[model samples]
Target: MNVGIETGPVRTGGYASSPERSGLAKFVSDTSAVFVREILLLLRDPMTLIFSLLQPLVFLALFGPLLTGALGQGSTAETLQWFVPGVIVMISLFGTSMTGSNLLYELMTGSYERILATPLSRSSLLVGRALKEFAPLVVQGLLIVVLCVPFGFILHPLHLLAGLVVLGIFGIGVGALSCALALAAQNREWLFWTVQQTVLFPLLILSGMMLPLDTGPGWMRTVALFNPLTYIVDLERALLGGSFTDPDVLQGVAAAVATCAVGLVVGIRRTRRTA
Candidate 1:
């Protein structure tokens, strides 16, 4: 009766069966999952995406021609070279600024709270949402640029890609901040709307995304100095114009990075509190 050592490999639970992911790896995985979820949601709403793009295209088609005369750049191509960057920035601004509203809607439906109940990282919720904005932004920007090409906009592949990268970074910050605002105004929807509208137009005008700040009144020029978007717009124009070595490029990069840092800090902290 040799009931000899019948010890088979001991069974282990899930955690012991697999090595735990490192902190950074876990974060990356969580963020990627959230990003994919957001993108899938976005894809389901094709009409919203189409409508979101219409305003920018209308601006290019109607306002673009007017800008040629206004800037007196001597050619439609030259004018577009200058105006296109601003329009793309405009898309980034408008597109990301309202991201909070989506979060707010989710809150109303209790989906946001349900998501927070999961084991997913809170910071990833905000970051992944912000990152999701980048795809539509890039697509809308590329389409706008392509349309402009027929109207004389020069296309430098590398420069265009780089400029979009910069815009995407800036947009992440804006989107994150928007998410934080959503968290703050979770109960007061009107507060979010009020604050968003109040802040957004000023940033747009002050950034000189639609007009040059060079000839603005003394006080306006001084005010523009405090607006980070001004530097980014200047940098975008410079990069798209093949002026990569321009001095303002450094400032723009710094501004984009700073915005991203601050927004992430605020957004992540707010998200954790919600959890």
Candidate 2:
């Protein structure tokens, strides 16, 4: 009865109203802003966007039809379906490699040093840069799907989602690796092209991207087994209704994980060293 006299409306403010979670909110806000800025920068580069989008289309148009004839009847549809994943993988690889050029550009202009001067975490800088590549890769992957629709390729939405996941993972892994390499590059400008050609051409040819591994010799098959890109392309193939063995899918997942692990370690070390 005596306690009833003290009852009143309680007013809570400051920490009681909105409690801080864990780490610095300022860091989260700043990193988010940086991510948005990077995405905008990528959007403004029309030529880069166009070239990135068109390269796969051109390859699809030229090589897609050629492989159809090479592989025999009904192979056109099969080959295009096969090429869908390969194109996504190729685009991811190409798109990620461009990170080197972007970083190099920043370095040349002293912008990178300025970024390093900020209170940003090195990991955030690395991740933010990689996030910049994700949107374009997704766009390119969707474009490939659209282009394939007219060619009689029907994709289940679930499978498409799975394929996109694979592409996203591939993009991140490749982008991280490329960023690390770019940091170590003495001449990032010229080395960008060199890395693209050297790393991509073989992966494209051997990963069953353009043709089946059965078309290759024994050594090439062995090489394909070890190539991380092979797993990416094969995973896409499996999702697209091509005949992919269980072992193939498992191998691919393992390879992609390994590549990603290696890339993460390298990217983290490189960022710390260079920053």
Candidate 3:
């Protein structure tokens, strides 16, 4: 006779125990789901992306000639070679920096709260939304580049690719920071727009995205040094110019990485607490 031993019952169908996903796997899955949802929304309402191109196009057409005339040294193509990179940066900045508004709208409509009720990690929510900005930014950048090519702007495939990578990295940070700001101003939407516009223009001008800082006053030059966008603009110029060995590239990479780190940290923390 054997000692009495009981066997456990096996669960069936949906009640069966399955292997739990690892942390990394779960995060990736959740992020992808959120990203796909965002893409769907973008496809449904594409006007925002289309309208975003207008400002950059206007700048390229109207201001580009003026820039060449003012400089009085370079050909139109040479001016565009320098100018187009800044325009790409502008595309990234304008496109990504305002992404928080969508989040803010969702918050007001309670859609975001519904999403928050899901099991998705807060980090994934922020990250997925930030990743959505990359598509539109890349599209705008490419369109601008292609449009400029006929005007004498040289096109280097590798350099443009590298520049897009930098722009994508920088856009991630700006977008995350924007979402964090939206969370902060969830109740006061005007404050979000006010702060965004107030800060964005100064950064744009100070970075010499439209005009060179060489002729600017010393104080303007000093302030530009502190703006992360300045490095990005410079780095884009260097890369497009085929100055592969330029030190600004390193500086730009460092700046973009730092911005991404800071933005993600702040966005995730705020979302965790607020949502």
Candidate 4:
């Protein structure tokens, strides 16, 4: 039986479907409405969006010329081919890692509880947030890649697709994990950051975002082998060079999928329980 109500939406205007709507249809509508709301909230203060890009931009400005030039041995093109993808990942890392703070803020302000009272599936809320992050990150990654063109960075169609795919997987996983952490921690802000910084910095460094690992110490390379970001970075470099059939790319994609799936499931489960 189609069990949706024909009632007015308490929030997310007109999001609630008619009373006769199917479960799947209602869920889709709710998720979409939630996604729109999230986007609108993000857009309301465009400065936030600009600031979000600031860190990566600063990193690129301060570090790009020096490191990329040195790394590529004066070949600016090769430098960007290595640097751009790492910048993308670094952006995702900073942006999504702190999503839990938003949730915590909502919870403290009673907004989250009100949202919980809505008839929409809790997973829709979580998924909507994930989609929100995914969209911008993709655009940001693309824009950065495009802007690098004048500097001699070459772009491949397949590389762009694969890079976006990898970043989407990374964003969703990180976003889901953020949500789960927020739910679990509730109002404990410090705990979230403590764990986040500990985990995040290691991943970023292990990824060798600023330096090539090929000449690094044996043990460091061995340690990086265990990090999923390392493989993703490897795939990005491969894609930058217009090669996609490498085994490492496949491994990286598989790792990304697994990580995203698991985090989403865990987050969805936690949100359901909270509801």
**lDDT against the true structure, each candidate:** 0.87, 0.73, 0.88, 0.81
| TM-score (C-alpha, index-matched) for candidate 3 | 0.92
In candidate 2, stretches whose alpha carbon ends up further than 4 angstroms from where it belongs are 1-31, 186-188, 242-247
Residue 140 C-alpha lDDT in model 4: 83
Candidate 2 lDDT at 83 equals: 69
Best candidate, TM-score-wise?
Answer: 3
lDDT of 2: 0.73
The order of the candidates by TM-score, greatest first, is 3, 1, 4, 2
Provide the lDDT at 84 for model 1.
91
Tell me the alpha-carbon RMSD of every candidate: 4.8, 8.0, 5.4, 3.8
lDDT of 2 by residue, 1-275 (tens): 56666444332320111233235664465457567878888777768877887888888888788877787748567777666777777788777777777887787888788777765667767767766677787777888888788887777777776667667666767778888878887455677668767887887788888788896799999998777888877777777764345556666677667776777678878999997
Error of 3 at 228 (Å): 0.1
- Looking at model 3, the pairs that clash are none
Models 1 onward score TM values of 0.91, 0.84, 0.92, 0.90
lDDT of 3 by residue, 1-275 (tens): 77886455333321222247548987887788888899999999998898788998899889988998887747999889889999989989988999999998999999888787776778999999998888888788888889888877888888888888988989999999999999999989999999999999999999999999999999999999999999999999999888778999999999999999999999999989996
Stretches > 4 Å off in candidate 4: 1-14, 17-19, 68-72
Q: If both were scored by TM-score, which would come out higher, candidate 1 or candidate 4?
A: 1
Give the better candidate number (1 or 3) by TM-score. 3
